[model samples]
Target: MSFQDWEITFEERTEELVEDYGDSWRLKFDDNIEPDNPAQDWFQYIRGAFARFQCSKCKKTWPSRRVLVVFHFRLDGRKRKGTVEARRFRQECRRCQEAKMEEPQFDSDNIEVLLEKLVERIRMRCYRETLDGIQRDFRPVGRSEGPHESSHCEACLKGVCRKAE
Candidate 1:
């Protein structure tokens, strides 16, 4: 179905999600389904989810009502401060999915590509959150010149400075 067609159904699902998650607003899909293009399906599911309301972050009506999809990964090795890592999928417009379906078969290679995309998405989201937190904490300090003007670490100071500059 076209995204426009899917939008109608997606709206209905979003209401259910609001009732279910309330403030948290997280939706986890079962991985067993094995969609033709799991990444596309993942995007479609999230787009459907956000169709219900305005996004808290962007404040813009969710474009195509899409939600960023991230895949969480953890290594089996030694102690790490943060055990989980994530990556996000590229925004898959519904048109892409429809077009992709015309191909003969969606195989493991496709899924692997999707997995990588999801991982990237997660990493970007995590980085964004970290930056946002740093900004929130340091906002009161006001903009400053020179390295030592801000109390934040050099990395953070550099980032903020770059953003300002």
Candidate 2:
């Protein structure tokens, strides 16, 4: 998938989450997920999706299906309120001699797919739904060549992203 406006995708996914989970859950995108939340049932989920990125200086474009995304959420059953925070990993242009870590650009389809899995995870974790019969397909729209470079990935640098076991 090519680049699309992340803000719009986030808003759309949030609306879907609200529609499915009702008004009790509040989802937000943050720079980082705070670890000091007082919620006892706080949980975390990590997902990967294919995204396109371009070097700001060199204009070099590349595709990566290893772009990692992290979600932290908690459901306060007593108050019937839930909170979720998300953060997406970034990558630097490998071709550039000196490049900044660029934000991943996700197309509408990829974003939808990613958020769909997120909703499923929420149902399994917060809603206590079993994952036995859930569909686990999270394959991206296109294939990315070469192996993922942890050296250029922001999440990898911070030890937030991990290889699939």
Please, what are the lDDT tens digits per residue for candidate 1 over residues 1-165? 233332333233334323532311222333332212333213221201111122233432212112223333322223321122222222212222222111111122333333333333433442222222221111111222323322222212223222222
**Ten contiguous residues minimizing lDDT sum, candidate 1:** 44-53
**Every candidate's lDDT:** 0.26, 0.71
Give candidate 2 regions above 4 Å deviation: 1-22, 34-40, 131-143
lDDT of 2: 0.71
Candidate 1 lDDT (Cα, whole model)? 0.26
Error of 2 at 152 (Å): 1.1
